[model samples]
Structures are given as structure tokens and as C-alpha cells.
Target: MPRSILSWSDRSLAAQFALAGGVVMVLSMLLIGRVVAARIEESVVRNSALATSQYMDSIISPLSQDIAEADTLPPGARRALDEIFTNTPLGERVASFKLWKPGGLVVEATDKTIVGRRFEVTDSLARAFAGEVRAEFQNLSDEEDRGEHALGLPLLEIYSPVREVWSGEVIGVAEFYEVATGLERDLAEATRNSWISVALVFVAIGGVLFLIVLRGSRTIDRQRAALTRQLGELEALSTRNTALRERVQQAAARASAANDRALRRIGADLHDGPAQLLSFAALRLDALRGQLAETGEIDAVERAVKDAIREVRGISKGLGHPDIEDRGPCEIVTGVAETHEARTGTKVAVICDLPEGLALSQAEKLCLYRFAQEGLNNAWRYGGGRGQEIRLDCRDGRLGLWVRDAGPGFPPEDAERHEAEDYSGIGLAGLRDRVESLGGSLTAGNRADGAGAEIGMELDLRGA
Candidate 1:
């Protein structure tokens, strides 16, 4: 389809409708004008034929046989013919006339030079000879008829058969050229009236159609505008949502880093204040036992003091992250994976693709270590630990840590079970909070290969 000048996108509905209506109106006017003009011309020719035929009969019926075929009229009859045509009121109405024989000869005419002249039989002449009257408005394109148009006036050409009054036999044909000035006026008036009527009807119909289309167009335009406005609002909302999500992730990351720092401080305080005191007490108990070998409670006191020191040391180890701030990211990730493997007996495969001397903040390194530690521990405990792999990759200013295990995967069917279990799902949630707080994301699910489960974390470290 061709594109519209007033396309739907570019123009309002009302304008489009108006343009279409205008085209239809113009086409209708042209069609109606042609029909009206054709009808008016036909009516004028038909009426002129009837009027001219009757008048010719009054003059020619009296001598139909006197001028039969090829100017065979006697001297007196010819004189009578000339007198009736030239010296009467009817003569003023007629421009010319001819009596034609069946053999295509002009039997008699007002132009005496044409008398007995043979002319080609025209369709109208042939029809008249066949006992039918024919009439037309002529431009005189015919060679024989051209001389008659020298007056520069339109003519009503009529062909009427001169019939016998008694037997109704068509004996000859009479061709009449009547002055069409008055007929032309009547036709003009009729044509003007028809055009006016058509125009009025066109206006009334087009107006009604335009009004209906305009209303619908306006409704459509309103809907489109409202939709556009709604779309704009939705786009703005989406942008804000993205910004809020980023801010939320950053806040979560900062919170996790703060929490880690607090725990590290607590661990240091416990080790320095409580663990040191326990160790000193254990040493004092050893001396007291030697001093009081007779007392039975010395061994019990020594064992209790040693046990308290051990527990304090264990608590401190659990609270602290790691002392690998000066190390590269690769060293930090590998250390966490190795440590987890040693503690859990779950052999982890570590793949490091980090660039050498990559700079990162302490919190970022801690976040990476924590993620690796949590991911490896979860894989061992929950994944059945058939096979384990840890991957650390840095590319395009983003760091990714992935831990996967070839064990029972996390499936949708096990979701409720995991949620109900304290250690199963809760640990992952804490890990997520920690990762998110550091402006990163964490995800845990079945591996793409369907053979294991995978837990991954991604952090943006462009400014690290």
C-alpha cells in the first residue's frame, strides 16, 4: 500500500478523515456533474426532435408525394415549397432543411446548389428512411453538414420521414436544421440547476460524514495521547527503579563491611583480653600444682584453664576474616578456598584469572574472601561434595567468584525444605546480604550442566 500524505502517525484522526472526505466529495462531484450534463443534453435533443418533427409535418405533409425522390417536383410545387419555408413565421425558427431520397440524393433544399446532390447516407438519415425519427445536437463535423454551421450557431438536427397520410408509408426523409439558441439556453439552465442540486447534496452528505469521522478521530487522538503520556511515566519509573536498586546494593555492601569490621574488632578484643588471661592462668595453675602436689583439685584447675584458652582462641579465629590485605586478590581467593577445603575435607578446585597487582580496598577483599568461604562451605554441606570447583575471574573491571559442586542440586521441589531448614537456606540469605551490602550480587542454583549446584557472586571493582 502507498503511504498516505496524512499518515496515521503524523496527523490527527480528524484531519485524516477530513482529507479522505474531501477526496470522496471531489470525485462524487465530477461523477454527478457528468451524469447531470449527459441527462440534460439527452432531454433537450429529444424534445427538440419532437417539436421540429411536428412543425415540419405541417409544411411537408401536404406535398409528401410532390417532391418524391431526387427533386421530381413540378414547377408549381417547387414554388409552393419555397414560399411556405421562406415567407412564414416558422421559417424564422428554422435555419435550413433538405428532402432526401432513399438513394442518398438531396431531393430539395433551401440551398438550391445542394438540390439533387448526392451525399453519403448518415446513420440519422438511414434511420429516418427506415420509418424512425432521429435527432441530435451537432457540431457539424460531417463534410455535408459543415456548410450549414458557417453561421457559427448551434443547430438542432432532426431527421423525420415524410409518410403517406392514408397508408402510413415512409416515402421520403426530411432533414431539418433548427436554430438552437433557445434550446441552448434551456439546456444551460437545466445543467446549472442540476449542478447546484448535486453540490448541495454533496455538502450535506460530506458534512455529516465529516462530523462522524471527526468525533471518532478525536476519541482516537485522546487515547493515543494518553497512552504516550502513560508510556513516558512508565519509562521514568523504570529509570528510578534502576537507580534505587543500585543504591540499595551499595548500602547493603557498606553495612556488610561495617559488620565485618565490628566482628574483627570483637575478635581482637577477645584474643587480647580473654585469651591472654586464660593462658596466664593456665601457667599459674601449673606452678600451683607443683607447689601443692598434695591438693587433688590442681589438675582439674589446670585442665579447665587450658580448655578456656582453647575456646577463646577458637572464637577469635571464627570472628576474624583473614590477614591478607597486603596480598593480591588471587592470593586472598585461593587462601579462602584452601582454608575451607582443609577444614571441611571437601577438595575444591580453584581457578584464578585475576590480573597481577590488581588494587582493591580491604572491604572489597573481605567481601571476596567471605563469599568464597561461604560458597565453598555451602557446596560441601548441601551439595553432597562429590566434586567441587572455585573460580575467581576479573575482566572488564568486574570480579566474579563462582563455587560449584557435583552434588544434589537446588531444585524447586526442595525449596520449601531448604527454607524450613535453619542452616540450609538461612546461610545463603546471610551471604546474599553480605555480598549485596558490598555493591555486589549473589546467586545460588543448579549448575547449567545439571550435574551439580553452583553459587556465584559478582562485584563491580572498576574504582577498586
Candidate 2:
């Protein structure tokens, strides 16, 4: 989650990416620098060697031609060889040059004292005497060599024979020595140029790399801040959700308590007021009947009293005056089934296989009673008072309730649209909400017989 180059010291993705890029940049620039440096060194070496070789070629032909006529005039020939080395085309082009006789005696050298002494550089002289030219390199043989002017690196030497042209007689040889100073100069210049190029390349690449690092750092910081903000928001949201759940629970409890109190008062009021008023009216009607025993008014009073008593009974049934709140959920459920059977004038069957003594919270009991009550009402209204069935059972510590009627179920589209419409009485939506509020589920569907609608609800009892 930490998105930065520094954060990637331990295999982070951002660090990995940046590291790979820097490595590639460094490698590519270094490789290019090395290739350019090598080429520059090669060119320097080639030019220096070419110039030295060309100067040697120019002096060689003239020295060989002049020396051929020398042995006959021995007096001036050695001096002539001396002049050949000192005044050659590139003055002092050969740091040291020598001429030797076929038997390896030094015929001539620029140093006059060693003209006749056997040359210490015998191998190089012998190579020339054998009629072959050879080039070589070595350290400056003296201890005084140092710095650019000194031949410290190595020497380049070319050795070749000078001979008699007409008779082919082996006479002498010439050996050229170019000390290491000359080669070192060319090499140093090449190194300097190479370093300059390296500096420029390093500067450009380093600038780009640093800029890339800067941009990447900024990006990582932004992402880190964003993630932190999101986490804070999520924590706040979770807290709010928990508080809302608690508030809902408290509201439901208060509502249930209030409903319970209202139900008891209503039950008391119906039993006291309506029952007494109807009883008083019946006694007065009996007294009037006796008083007018022989008159037609007596018959009329008898009919009016009978009508008032029947009306009161009807009002009580609709109000669910006694059965609604006077009993437990189980009794209330059983009583509704019996009332439906009697009032609908249809065959209403009830199959109650519930275990006895099932306990429920007040909220849970109210939801169960209301759901069953509305289901029966819907079945009676829609089924046109035809056959109805009700079922309730308890097993595995859970309860299941069902109500059915022998009539076509509501059209699927109409049910979906009108299910929310609650003009009066408890509709299907209210019943469903009631069931769900108590942590139970209710569903409606066509009965298995393919001719009716069935409503089912299930609830956990002890688990509720």
C-alpha cells in the first residue's frame, strides 16, 4: 500500500519499477561510453603508428641507397651513417637509430664512442641482419623515465637491413627506436576525450533519472494520502451503520410496548361498553313485549330487539374484539381458522402440528398473528369464499405457517405493481413487512394443485 521508491526497499512494486529503470539507464549509458572510448583510443593509436611508420619508410630508402657504396670508403661511411640518423626527414623521428655489420658488430651509431663496440641490442640487430623488418615495444630501459616526456609506457622499434644492391653482398642493418613517450601522448589524449564524453552522458542521464525519481515520489505520496483518506471514511461509515442498527432496535421495542398497552385498553373498552349497552336494550325490549302482549306493537318491538342483538354480534366479530388480543399467538391463530370456516360458509380446514408450549417475544408473536390474519383475509376475498386451507407446524425448533385458497392467484404483473398499494386494511405489503421485522420470511405463490394461491411464512422459535 505504501507507494514510493523509498517504500520499496523490501520488494515494493514502485521501488522495483524505479530500480529497473535506473539500472537500464546506467547500463546503456556506460556501454555507449565504453564503445566510444575504445574507438577513440583505436583511432589515436592508428594515427600515431601510421605517422611513425611513414616517416620511417621515407628515411629507409635513402639510408639504404647511400650506405651501399660505403664499405669501400670506410673513412666517411660511418660518418655518413651518423648523418643518416640525425638529419633524416623527420629530425629525430627515430629516438635512436643504429647500423650494424653482418657479424653483429656495431658499424655505426649516433654515439661515436660505441661505433665499433658490439651492440648491446643484439637480438634487434640480428633480426635486421637476417633481411626481415620487425616492429616491437618495451619500457624505457633507464631509471630516469617519468611523466609525459619520458618513455614510461612502452617503445615501438622497427629493425631492417641495409644492403649492397648490385652484388647482393650482406653489408649492414638499420634499427629505429621510438621511445614510449610518443605513444603515451596519443593514449592520454584519447582518454581525456573519452572522459569528456562520459561526463556529458552522465550529466544528461542523471538529470533525466533524477526527474523521473521526483515524479514517481510525488505519485506515491498522493496514492498513500488517498488510501489513508479512504480508510478513514470506511471506519466512519461502519460506525454510523452500527449506531443506526441500534436505534432501529430501540424504536421497534418501544413501538411493541405501546401497541400492547393500546390493545389491552381497547379490549377492556369493547367488553365493558358494547356488551352492557346491548344487554340493557334486550331487557327493555322484553319488558315492552310483556306490557303490550296483545298488541301488534308488541310484535314490532320483538322484531326491533332481535335486530339490535344480531347487529351487535356482527360488530364484535369484525372488530376481532376478543380473539385478537385476549389470547396467545397459538390460540389467536386457531381461533381465526375456526372463524373463517364459520363465516365464509365454505370448507376451511386447519392442520396444526405445532409443538406445544412454544414461546415467542411480543414482537415476534404480533407479527405472526398479523401475517396469518391478513393471509386468511386475502384468501377469503380473492377466493370468493371457496375452500380454504391453513397449516402450521413446528419441527427442528422452527415454525412454518401456510394459508391457501382454491382460486387463481393475482396476475404476476398486477401483484408486483399493486402489492405496494395499501388503501385500507392490512395488505400483502404490510403483512410482509411485519413478518420481516421479526426476522422471519414470507412468500406467495400458486399452490401445487395448480388452481389456487398459497402463502407461506417461516420463523425460528427459540432462535428468533
Candidate 3:
């Protein structure tokens, strides 16, 4: 109901239960104790009244036989009542006595003023006339009880039926007040005991429930703490994994760049050293051809030298890296195709469907160039450069490149073996590594239409 109470209750499961259950237990105990005390007091008063009424009935029933026919008790009966009250031990215990005819008429009473008086018929008096005994303790509210009230002590007021001796029919009612100091003391003791027992039982139950709640609350708290610790550990591990992955990707990019630089150096070395030596040998052989008598050997030697120079130059040209850093994805791919066509004298079909202003990282650009270069070279060498097609496009934020040829595809078994082979040159396997370094993948297989073989590479632009 209040913020402070709610906050306190939320402190723990046990506290919550204690706050709510304690209130219920206390209210229940009070209600049950009050009811038990009331029942005990009522039982004690009724029993005391029954005993007093029975003893008085024994003495008065015989004297009051004339009351069955007459409205008032005769003088003789009245005198007996006076004698019993004045001279007997019963008078010491009883505070006052009265005899009533039906319809609220008091025919006789120890107090002479209330005799022959008519008062309102009370519930107890009516019950007594109907042949039942009713009793109340210390209740002096009736007009007839004014004298008893003046006595100023606890009194058990009793209304008992008087029956005709022969017929057992109720004819008159006897109402009396008995001094009940002992009963009052007994009721007080009983009420005290009842309240104590109820309180003790409720407390015990509350304590047991609290213990259960406390045990469960402790268990849950432990589990929650453990789970929190575990979650923290998992989060830390995840962060470490993310950092490691980024490091790996950076290493791969650096490696790819280093490999490209090495290839360019090797191409430069071949072109500057071996091509010059082979060209000089060819020129010297041509000069010596005229001096030889049998010119066939000289011609063969010169042709061989020329072929060696041509091959070395071609290899150097293929190995040399192109200046593609400033170009977009479409221009890079188209340039590679055009270069391949000019070198091999073969026409290449170039399909560029990339979005305008497409961008890529340096690593990705290098990977794409090498992929197209290697793919077209393979087509020329293995497939006679027939029906060569380079397809490029950007789809769903990923850049795709495909080089296809109208030649027999790789055999399934050889293709699988080739994927696992170590590639030292700028071949399919090495190209695969370069692509994968930029978070891209390369796949070599037959075209879906069965018209050619296709080598495809895809890179995620977002990751780049």
C-alpha cells in the first residue's frame, strides 16, 4: 500500500512472506481466541445457572403448586420463599430471586417493590416459559435487575421453567441472580489460557513457514548470482573471440598484399635479366647464319632462341601486376578481360551489371584482378579461349565475378583434388586464398547450362 512497505517487502522472499503472513496469522489468532473465550464463558455461566436453578426448583416447586391456577403466589408460598432466602445457606450464594407468571407479571420477588409488577418480557424469560433454561453473566440491564445491579458484583442471571408436578407442563418461570465472583475468575483464567495457546500456535506456524521461505529464498539467490557470473564470463569470452577474428582478417589482408608484391618483384626480375640474355643470343645467331655452310642448324638455333625470348616475355607480362587501385569494380574487371584478349588475340565477352559508383578496399581490388587474370589465362591455355565470358555484378550488397568458357569443365574428381592442392603460382588455388583473405569465396565448376566451365568469386561489400 505504501512505497516504503513495498520496498521492504521486495528485499527478500522471506521478508515479503513475513509482512503478509504475519498480519494474517495475528488476525486469525485474535478472532479464534475471542470466540473460544466467549464460548467458555457462556458454558461456565449456563452450567452454574443450571445447578442453582435445579436446587431452587427442588424446594420451590412443591410450594408453588397453587401458581398453576392463580395469577399470584399465595401468602403461604410467599412466606416460604422469604424463609428460604433469609434463613438458608442458599441465600448467601444467591443475590436475588423472582417468580414470574406468563406475560411478564412478577408474582413474587425478594425485593418487595418489584412484586406484582409487569415488565417487558425478555428473550430469556420467554424461552424459560417455553420450558428452557437461559442464563447470562453480569447483565443487569432489565428493570427487574435494579436491585441486583446495586449489589455491584458479578451475577449469573438465570431464567428457569417451573413445571406442574403431575403433568410436566410449564406453568411459571423462575428468574434468579447468583453471585458469580468465582465463575468470573475462572472465565478470566480460561480466556487468558486460550489466548496464549492461539498465539503460540500461530507463531509456531508463522515461524515454520518463514523458515521454509528463507531456505527457498536463499537457494534462489544463490542460483541467480551464479547465473549472473556465468553470463559475465560468456560475454568476456565473446568479446575475446571477436577481437581474435578481427586480428585474423587483418593478418590475411597483409599476407595477400605481401604476396602480390613478391609476384611483381619476380615478374620484374624475369623481364630484366632472362629476356635480355635470350634476345642477345637470338641476335648473335642471326649474324652467324650467313657464315655457316649448312644454314639449317644455324636457323634452328636462332628460331629456338627467339621462341625462348617470346615465352619469357609472355610469362613476365602475365606475372606483372597492373595499376588498378584507382579504378572501380566494373573497370577493374573490364580491364582484366581486355588485357587478356589483347595478349591472346581472343575475344572475351564482358557482362558488367554492377551498381554505379561501386567501391571496394585495396585488398578486394587485388583479389578481383588476380581472379580474372588467372581465370582467363586458364581458359586460353586449357579451353582454347572459346566462348570466354566475364560476368560482374553487385547483388544484395555483395559483389560477384564469374569467368566462363565454352570448354570441357574439370572432371569432378580432379576438381575436388585441385581444391586441396597447394598452389605456389597465381593459379586457382592461390586465387582462392587471395579471395578468402578479403572475406570472399571462390568456386570453380561447370556452368549450369552445361555450355562451359565457370569460375566464380563473390565478396561481401559490407564486410569490406
Candidate 4:
């Protein structure tokens, strides 16, 4: 299982370039160091070769003087020259000399037996005979074999013109061998110096780079923290916006309900209070009319007075005013039936099946009373002016107020269905608004049980 990085900036680039750079730097230090050391070795070898050449020149000068001073052909003098030439060292870095006649013939050599051979023979000898310093490296073809024995080995050969002391004529060729112990020593010294320098350089670069990375990391952390705080603020603002919208919706619903309740209360006041006062005054005027007939004191004035009181009572009832809330819904329904009995000579059946002291709110009680008043008024005024009966019931969690008549029920589409002026019990529309808001239902039409008209309402026990 791999662990996740807990922070953003702790990761380092572990890649090929870093590894390669380390490897290359080490290898380069080794190689360049070797080159520097070898140069030192070559310099020492060159110095030794030059010193050896000078020593060989001293020996050659004395031998040539002794040979030139021999005026007669003497065997002893020849024997001495041969001994001196044969005494040369065979080690590397020693000069190997060759003498040539003016006609390009080899007369003497550092190799005593091969002396007197023609100078125009092998390629190296032919080049030397032409007065050129025929220098070469590695007798064979290996690159590391460079700068070794060097005659026919790794060597840098210098050919100086050797002349006879008296005649000043060209004589032999001199070749010096270069060796490379100095090159190896110098390369080792260079390797040590370069390693220290490269290490110090890398340390300085790494330190600077690390500091820059550290500062950058701190700046990024600060930015991230600030952004997180801003995000938190934005989230809080969003929550406040949502709460404000909810409060606004609640306020709108409450305002609409308040307007409906106010209209209902106004209607109830007109129907129950003012309307009944006017109606009672009209009944007194009819009594006054009887008295006027007996006294004959301005009969026209008494008739006009009664007419005016009746009109005022009609106006109040149309505005939904009446004295009805004083009694219980059961008593109101039964009394309206008694009025129907008196005015149209009809009977009404009313039943009360509610729990004792079954209380109700002001709006619900008013609605029940208004419904009963209109039912009785409809029976007295329009049920053939005579013979109809209404049945009312209260039962199991409901007040079932209904009225029925034997007179012709109006059509379902009658203009009086919800007309306030026609029905007048604080208006059918007002009854519906109150009952339904309390989770009850009201309906008006012909009775489902019979052919006469019926109007009934139901109230939920809990809601009422």
C-alpha cells in the first residue's frame, strides 16, 4: 500500500536527469583529472629527453674531434672509435644516433653491427636521412599505447643537425625517447583538485535553490489559507440568504390569512348584531299600525313609518346583520324552524347529537348560525309560501346542518346558488370560506334522498 502525500510541496522530482548529472560529474572529474596528470608526466619526460640529448651531444662532439684529428690510417684509432660507439645504453630515453655520407650512405649507428647500412632503407630511416625529425607515437595501432618507447614506440623525437667541428658539414641524426610516468603522476594530482572544486560548486547551488523553494512554499500556504477563509464566508452568506427567503414566504401567507379572517368577522358582525336590532324595531311598528287604525290619527303617516322600518330591517339582513349568536347552534336551528312554522305554516325536524358542552370557536359558531338562518328564510319566503319541512342532524364528530323542502327545488344552475342578495344568511360564499378553512365542507343543491332542495354543512370535530 502507498501512503498519500499529506502536503502539496513536499514532493521532490526523482528523475533520470539528477542521477545522470551526478554520474557525469564524477566521471568527468576522473577523466579530466587524468588528462591534467598525464600532461605533467609528459612535461617531465620531455625535460628528461632534452637533458639526455644534451649529454649525448657532449659525447658525440669529443668522438667526432678524435676521429677527425687522426691524420694517418691507424687501426688503433679505429678500435677506439668502435669502443666508444658501442658503449651506448640500450634503455628507453637514450639517444639512438645514425651517421650518413654526403652521398646518403649510413656509416655508423647506435647499433654497432648494423653500422654502415644505407640511410635510404626503411621508412623511418629514409625520413631521418632527409633531415626531417621523423617523430611518431605507438609503433602499433592502440590509442593508449601513445607516448611510450617511441623510436618505433610511443615517442616525440627531435632531430637536430649534427655537424663536424672543423668542416661544419652535416653528420649523424639524433633521436630522443619520451616516457610517460610523468603523465600518470600529473593526472592523479589533477583528479584530486577537480573533485574538491566540483563538490563545493554543487553545494553552493543546492543551498540557494533550497532557500528559494522554501520561500515559495510559505507564500503558497498563505494563499491557500486565505482562499479557504473566503470560501467559509461565502458559505455563511448563502445560508443567510436561504433563511431570509423562508421568512418572506411565511410573512406572505400570514398576511393573506389575516385579510380573509377580517372580512369574515365584518360579515358576522353585520349579520348577527345590527340586522336583528332593525328586525325587532320593525315588529314594534306593526303593533303601532294596529293602534293607528283604531285612533284614525294620520293613517298614511303610520303606514309610511312601518314601511320605513321594514326597509331598514331588510337593508341590515342583506348586509349580514342579525341576532343569532346569542343561542346555541341547536337552539338557533329549532327556533328558525318555529319561525318557518309560523310564517309558511310548515314544520321542521331538528336533532342535536353533540357531546354536552361541545364548544366551538367564534368563526365556526357564527358559520353554523348563519347557515340555519338562511335555510329558515328560504323555507318561509319561497317554499310555495306554505307547506315544507326541513330536517337537521348533529352526530359523531360532525354538525350535519341540512334543510329540505317539499316545494319545487330550483335548478342546479340557479342564479341564487351563491348570490348574497338572494340567499342572505351572511351569504353562502361567506359560509363556505369559514367552514372550509376549518377543514369542514358545505354543499347546496337538491336533496340526494328526495326531490326537494337541500343545503348542508359538515364540521370536523377536532378542527372545529
Which numbered prediction scores highest in TM-score against the true structure? 1
**TM-score (all chains, Cα) for each model:** 0.61, 0.43, 0.54, 0.34
Candidate 2 lDDT, 1-464, residue by residue in tens: 55674456655444565678668767876787788877776566545555665556555544555455543225555455566666665445556665666665555555556556653545645666676565554533422112212534355655665657666554666655666575667677777778777868776876687678768877887897899899999999988986776577547656654654565555456546775676687678777766764757766766776676665555444434343444655676777777666766666677778666666666666666666666777777777756687888887877888888887776766642224221124467766756665556788877767777888888766644
Worst 10 residues of 4 by lDDT: 140-149
The sequence of per-residue lDDT tens digits that candidate 1 reaches over residues 1-464 is 44764365588767776877788898989898879888888987988798779878877877667654335767776788788779787777778888887878887788888887898888888989998889888657766786688878879888999987777788888888888888889888888888888989998998998889888988988998999999999999988997888688667767776777787888899899999998888888777876774757888878888888887876677678768769888888788777776766778888989887778877678777776776776677778667888898988988898888898878777632232122112366777777776667887778888888887888888633
Specify the highest-lDDT model's number: 3
Q: Write the per-residue lDDT of candidate 3 for residues 1-464, one digit (tens) a residue.
A: 99997888568878778888998888889899999889888888888888888988898789877889988888888988899888678888887999999999988889999888899999999999999999999889988788899999999898889999999999898888888889889989999998998899889989999999999989988998999999999999989987887688789999888877886787788889999998888888888887888999888888888898887777777777678889987888889898888888999999999777777888888888888888888778767899999998889988999988998777776653234221126678788878887778888887788877788989888855
**CA lDDT of 26 in candidate 2?**
70
Each prediction's Cα lDDT score?
Answer: 0.78, 0.63, 0.84, 0.54
Candidate 4 per-residue C-alpha lDDT over 1-464 given as tens digits, one digit per residue, 9 for 90 to 100: 23543332234332223344457666766666567655655565456545655665666544544333332214553465455545534344433444444334444445555445443344554555465445443233322122233435334444333456777644545443444345345545655665566667665665565566666756766787899899999889988986775465445435434653554565556556655665566567567766754645545555665665555455443444345556666766666667556744656666665556766655556566666766666655555533454454557677777766665776657723633334344456766665565567888776665566666788766532
Name the better of 1 and 3 by lDDT: 3
Output the better candidate (3/4) by lDDT. 3
Model 3 ranges off by over 4 Å: 235-464
TM-score of 3: 0.54
Model 3 residue pairs with clashes: none
Better of 2 and 4 by lDDT: 2
Off by over 4 Å in 1: 1-20, 54-84, 98-134, 160-174, 209-249, 260-376, 387-404, 410-413, 416-426, 431-450, 454-464
What ranking of all candidate models by lDDT puts the best one first? 3, 1, 2, 4
